[model samples]
Target: MKVPARQALQMYCAHLREQAAGRASNGELDLVNERAGLAKAQRERIEMQNAVTRGELAPVTLIEEVLSKAGGKIAGILEGIPGAVKRRVPALSGDEIKNIGAEIARVRNIVASMSLADLRDSGAESDEDRGAGSDEVIDA
Candidate 1:
């Protein structure tokens, strides 16, 4: 229809002719495919960069760090509760506290093992996006 499209059609037709004559193999076609894939990948990277700049997306590590900090705060609160458990309930003694601690640890492990699949599925909202283009890796 357009000049560039017409030229590309002509070139493809020439390649097809060469193939029909057994003068050219699919190697050229494969190269073209690879180049198209590379171009697509590069375009995606640019679009992702732009999204980050606009605060529409954030880095994985940043999200991990935020989650880690929240987890740490929760752990601190949980740890404090064990000591208070004895004072709050006077009749609770001996291995009771220890058992409670063990159960808490077990529950924590189960919760920690829970899949984060739901988080990955959800769309990142506009207002909450932060830490654009930051590649900071969380050690957790």
Candidate 2:
């Protein structure tokens, strides 16, 4: 890799000779690399400590728990849509509300059932839209 640059330098000195440019032993190079790695790790540790002191970083478990709770709240709100519809639209009959609930459940299941693993294992499944003989009703 250094050959091109070294060749270009020959134009400046005709009598110049090349010598061993590497360490006497692999152990010497390894020691230098180890010290460089130690310095990098120390810097990383200091950065993490500084972030924690500034309250910019949180534990992974705490973050996961907060996100999970928020997702649960959203799911609960989505599950209540049918009841809200029934309350607001009193003209809709019981069967119509049941059908709405069934449609909501189908959508919820479609969202909840999808995963990276499921996609990798069997690809994506096609879903039929509402009023396609889907009679299962889920009570919120």
Candidate 3:
């Protein structure tokens, strides 16, 4: 059976509310807001998945748009780090350069994993659409 978009949204909202309540109980306002933001993003993702399922949008289009925004963010992070490193040191030693390079590679790997997860989620949603029809939603 396919779940309606409204039901999915309600469930997601309820889940968010529960998380927020738990955080509040723990007296963690910062954590609550951070979790709320993540919940909001998840909600948006659900909507995007629905749009893809309904043939209202293409998955590739959404993926490319998201990746472009993520690329900009990654670029900004990369740009800012070099200036910070330079400000903290007169000049970087070869070893320091190598260490920084390794750190960058590690961060790049994390970014790549995140991107891959997004792609995998989109593909899974596409498969769900094929198997169960437009309203059939799965949490990716």
Model 1 segments more than 4 A misplaced: 1-31, 111-140
Compute each candidate's TM-score over C-alphas.
0.52, 0.53, 0.33
Q: Which stretches of candidate 3 lie over 4 Å from their true place?
A: 1-60, 115-140
Give the Å shift of residue 104 in candidate 2: 4.1
* lDDT against true structure, model 3: 0.70
lDDT-based ranking: 1, 2, 3
Model 2 ranges with Cα > 4 A deviation: 1-29, 93-140
| lDDT tens digits, residue span 1-140, model 1 | 56798899999999888777655647556555566789999999999999999999988999889989998888887777778998899799868888778667765765576558735745753322333344436698
Instruction: Give the Å error, residue 21, model 2.
Output: 16
Minimum summed lDDT over a 10-residue window in model 1 is located at 125-134
Return the clash pairs for model 2, or none: none
Better of 1 and 3 by TM-score: 1
**Per-residue accuracy of model 2 over 34-98 as CA lDDT, tens digit each:** 66789999999999999999999999899879967887887898889889999999999999998
Candidate with the greatest lDDT versus the true structure: 1
Candidate 1 local Cα displacement, residue 6, angstroms: 25
